[model samples]
Target: MEFEEVLNNLKLEKENNLAQECLNEIQNRQVLFHSGFEQEKKELTSLYRLRLKTAMDLNRDKFEEDVLANWKKTIDELESCSAKKLKLNWVRTEFKQFMIFWNSETKKLEGIFYLYPKNTIKDQEEYNTGIINGGLTVGSKKYNKGTFIKEWK
Candidate 1:
């Protein structure tokens, strides 16, 4: 079915708004692609693909507004094709910073909390204890460690 039709069917639920937002982002990205904004399009495409995993979270009613705002902010920044861009796959909170990615094998978006030590000695010491136990909490849900080790480390 067409994307619009899918949104139509979801009209009675909260998913409708989320689905519409996705469609709008998709359309915005496509317009950028056709306008010859290659770099911006590439970055936004990665985000768009990453966003597909949110549907499951939304259905479970565990989605967080802060994360959604984070995503929308990133999208707006990228869509503007501006030099001041937030780092991709990184989510920062007041207490911690997380690297997030979709784990293809598990079909889930996972986050890993990371702290960059102020000095080399501390960095080496902390590197030894990286990948903390109990996984990472994104929004209201906890996800297992992402399998993309190179990116996380």
Candidate 2:
């Protein structure tokens, strides 16, 4: 029974990983839309990115620390979230948004450093954890939750 349980858990983990990968692919595949709508979307995205960049560049240390703290606080609030079923998500901070998730398989808390230009609720921005640009450090590797801010500049 114990062996069976372990196998089931492993299967779930694999499924989760695959699902995440699929989502990443979708994010990378840019879509074409009506010229007007496309232009509007692009403008909004650019505006948000600019704001997020300015916030981070102004005082990188403060932005990083605050983002990390908010992510941790979010994790703390999720009663059901744990290493076994830990899921990473983007939580808002003063300047921007940061992602936090625990990869039980890797035994490391992963931080996705993305500068979300706007509030997630309005944008519904899909997870692009693969793209760690804009001076943010996002990757596939595991990270320590405690020292997340210092993980990247």
Candidate 3:
């Protein structure tokens, strides 16, 4: 769907503005294809393509079946073009940030993107735990007497 159409639909949701921003960020990254995570497993573009080429080797059929179950529209888009993914907007609570992205391959748009210290509990004690020790926090959420209220962090 077009951005305007998606934005219009999101307008019905409580945090439509954030949802729009999340979508915009995702699309922009997809367009730019930037190295999203500096800490992500270092990879060469050729190797990444090779991995994707064979990524479905083991579970191609099962993967399609699952995606069909969770998001038929996404499947349709993939069939027409290639795989597409969509998910709920970003939400930030007190400590952690939550942002999930569904893939056209994965049938269900589910998973807590990441909650980690980049090291094990034991390793964290040994190491400084880079991921967890963070001061700059961004994003926001809303909750007010069973209603919604936006708060920046």
Candidate 4:
């Protein structure tokens, strides 16, 4: 369903405080995910620059190997954590930082967009289609950004 519809339905469950809390927790997780994604982007950019400088000014093989090894260790940790479900309180306390670290390390290997491809046009199309199929919008006009025909009009 549309984000608005989803929120409306969620509000209806306000009578059940636990359900409301669960929804809040999920929303918080999404926020954490996005924040982590952005932080990772920055860290990857910095690491890329550092590695390039190190290779140019110092030892190429040694620098590259060290960075790669660090990256591999990060990937292993993320894989292990993802295999298990996290508790809500733990998620609240640690999710954003954990996600940032997870994202930063993953980006070091596969690139940032590899993890969250949502920024791509193809991904956007797929997501929009899913939203429509879920009865979230009546038509593309209701959700498509390009529907704004004005060029600063």
Candidate 5:
């Protein structure tokens, strides 16, 4: 099954379980008055909250992993499909189109790279330089000049 399907199933299961537990607790008056019940309720609530937070974290991590795995698989398929179309040791038009489609769907290359071919070597160099300058401009705008460098390192 696809990664998204797996994630959707997991999310649905979690929601259903939570709803059933909530209904059962309400039916039983699980937190109703009893000696030390308040304290026990508080502890259980905390534990539930912690477990929920952990589950959310795990879900996010799993989603990211799935996305990356699917992306890699897509790239591999594209490479195999384009193997016969390669020209001058560079990717062909079909591969370029595939990349564009992938990037558009993923938004993974936005504000990062522009992978188009230029008419000339000089234009290609200029494009690369422009991309680097643009990255620096964006970085400076979002943060203090050295902030990212320091934080990342």
Candidate 6:
């Protein structure tokens, strides 16, 4: 499966499980205690929150590991071949795009990078078009918070 699809599935599973747990808790509370369950409810909520955060952290770590491993494999393959320039795009809960080029003189892969926010397709296309041509002119759009100028070193 694609990386993005895997992420989406993971998220959906988490949400569904959490929702079901919440519904069950509500039903149990209603059946067990009609008057004095406030403290217990608070404690349960706190525990659930902690568990939720831990689950999220684990998922994030797994996702990052998968992404890095895939990237290493791709880079290794490129190095073995005659590929010159490659553009890689990823949406890591947001949009990120970067380019790498094989530098014959330096005997290395060099990259120029730009990050873009997850936005409407029209906006994304317009912003990426500017980047591909050369560089984005200063103060071009409102979604400038996602733009980052960096190089792969």
Task: Write down the lDDT that model 4 would get.
Answer: 0.34
Query: What overall lDDT goes with each candidate model?
Result: 0.32, 0.34, 0.32, 0.34, 0.27, 0.32
Query: What's the ranking of the predictions by TM-score, best on top?
Result: 1, 3, 6, 2, 4, 5
lDDT of 2 by residue, 66-88 (tens): 55444334334333333333334
Candidate 1 residues 2-45, lDDT tens each?
22332233232344343334334333321110111112344544
Misplaced by over 4 Å in model 6 are: 1-63, 84-153
Residue-level lDDT of model 5, residues 94-147, one tens digit each, is: 111011111223222111011222244334335445766676421111112112
Error in Å for residue 88 of model 3: 5.5
How many residue pairs clash in model 5?
A: 0
Per-residue accuracy of model 4 over 81-137 as CA lDDT, tens digit each: 422221111111122111123222222212111121224434444666677678774
What TM value does model 6 have?
0.22
Give candidate 2 misplaced runs (Cα > 4 Å). 1-39, 65-153
| Alpha carbon deviation, residue 39, candidate 2 (Å) | 8.4
Instruction: Judging by TM-score against the true structure, name the best candidate.
Output: 1
| Candidate 3 residue lDDT tens string, 1-153 | 223333344344444343444344333321111112211112322333353345356545544443333233322332343224333333332222333333324323222222212333234222322333464433322332223333223
lDDT for each residue of candidate 6 in 46-84, tens digit (9 for 90 to 100): 443464355446645533444444344444444454434
Off by over 4 Å in 3: 1-83, 103-107, 115-141, 151-153
Residue 4, model 5: lDDT of 26
Backbone clashes under 3 angstroms, per model: 0, 0, 2, 1, 0, 0
Residue 141 displacement (Å), model 5 = 20
Q: Rank the candidates by lDDT, best first.
A: 2, 4, 6, 1, 3, 5
